[model samples]
Target: MVSIIGHHLINKEEGYQILLYLDPQLIEVADEFDESFQNKEDLRQVVNSYVKNRLPDLKVTVIRVVLGSLVIASIPLLPGTEIKDLDSSQELNLKTEVKEVFENTPQEIEKDLLLVNKNNSLADNYTPLNLIVPEVPFIFKGFHEKKLMAAKAATALEELFAAAKANNIELYAVSGYRSYQRQEVIFKSQVEKHGLLQANQISARPGESEHQTGLAMDVTSPQVKFKLVQEFGVTKEGQWLKEHAAGFGFIIRYPEGKDAVTGYQYEPWHIRYVGQEIAQKIASQDLTLEEYLA
Candidate 1:
């Protein structure tokens, strides 16, 4: 009985590990191997095939047992996967390996960490996976494409918004996801109104925009008249977000003085979800995503 476990090191120092234990039945015929002997292609194919067969009903529970408590990561998993108890000794060993992976090696970039900038552009036909509208107050009144965010980001945005509300700070979603065509129209308008140079500073050109990634959201407060402006950074809501956004897996993508690195003017309203651990690291170090990646 071999258990094929796929473990992603979320935060090794904190012992945060996300383990996906594929049901033995799912890969019963595959050779028994642990994390040390990962066959990435084979494992991906097996899981993907199982997911493809299920189609629309592929909701799965990923378990994270920390210390003696069971914590759920609330992300999808392959069906038939069960949570196995990891004794204290097994957990300690797992944490050590995860820590080594976290500190010693560079892993593939995740979707949440996808970078879209002037230099690194997304394809015209590129669309994010798992885009969904978050349940939060929006500046606009009707359903629009801008209301959508990637599923994971949407969940984090909701949590951030709720935290703001709990503290009596009102935040409104200004813009969420944007398609390449929409971004093109926006860029053209900006260029026509502000000329090419200024437009390039204030807006992104088509595929170069982070809004197309579905992981960024432009947020504002009533103080800023629900507009995306630098003044929003000084508002109470904005200040609150800067200090606490990372706690909910978001970062103020563009800060006051990093325009040279980010290739844009400071946009304090634009927040990108990069997961809690990375977001905290970026915020703590005061490094732009480009700087962090570099």
Candidate 2:
């Protein structure tokens, strides 16, 4: 019962071809091999021991082994191939790959890098600590709740609005820091008016909205009549934000052509604060929050 087993390192056809031309009698002895063997080196030692005692005339190189029903082999490392050795310093850094850290965990929500979407929802009670009302111009006066944002985010928003004002671009803060209850109301209203499918593209279910994070804000301009509409994206204030928001640690979260990934329409009015470093990185790459975190 001759058999061939391919190592993961070698191409399947190449490994089988190498075994095909070996002596038939030698191939038959592979069935007698112990199941404990792991790779070529282990099989080589076992075969050498068995052949020396039982059949001195037959010389063979055990290129493969099968432990129970599992086949195993080892191919020599080729030039330029990376080896993962625990003792090596480089291998330590490889342990912290972003996918390994954030995949299958809800801890990202507690951190500033939380990814909230239709698939990843926040808890109904979740609210960012240190929420404060940013000192910036708004479409209306005395809407304190709507002007609120996380402390760091509020500071960044203030700076962002100040910069725009200096450049003669008058921006108006329309909405920010929406509570879970407010989102529920908004979502229900959207559903009632536009149907569920269309509502999902425009408004998020209570816990799924980024507005609940206190790290997101909706901005508009007088040119758009201070309304949260698509035309706001084309306004001079919106264009300035698209160009410079990242400098102040903000990003246009739901960007154009990324509705499929974000599960929302292009909301040029929506900006999210993710710290200067990550904000700039996401902006430079022209990536959505989902792609950046992923």
- Candidate 1 runs further than 4 Å off: 1-110
How do the residues 1-294 of candidate 2 rate in per-residue lDDT, one tens digit apiece? 222211111223222101111122343444443444234343444333322332233222222222222233322222333222111221100111122211333323335676777755554556677899999988888856778999999999999999999999999898989888888899999999999999988999887888888999999998988888888888888889999999999999999999898999999999999888998999999899878866
Best prediction by lDDT: 1
By summed lDDT, the worst window of 10 consecutive residues in model 2 runs over: 86-95
lDDT of 1 by residue, 93-170 (tens): 122113222232222223577666764555465577788999999988989999999999999999999999999999
Model 2 / residue 72 / CA error / Å:
36
Local distance difference test, candidate 1: 0.68
Per-candidate alpha-carbon RMSD to the true structure: 13.9, 19.6
Residue 61, model 1: Cα distance from true site in angstroms: 46
lDDT of each: 0.68, 0.65
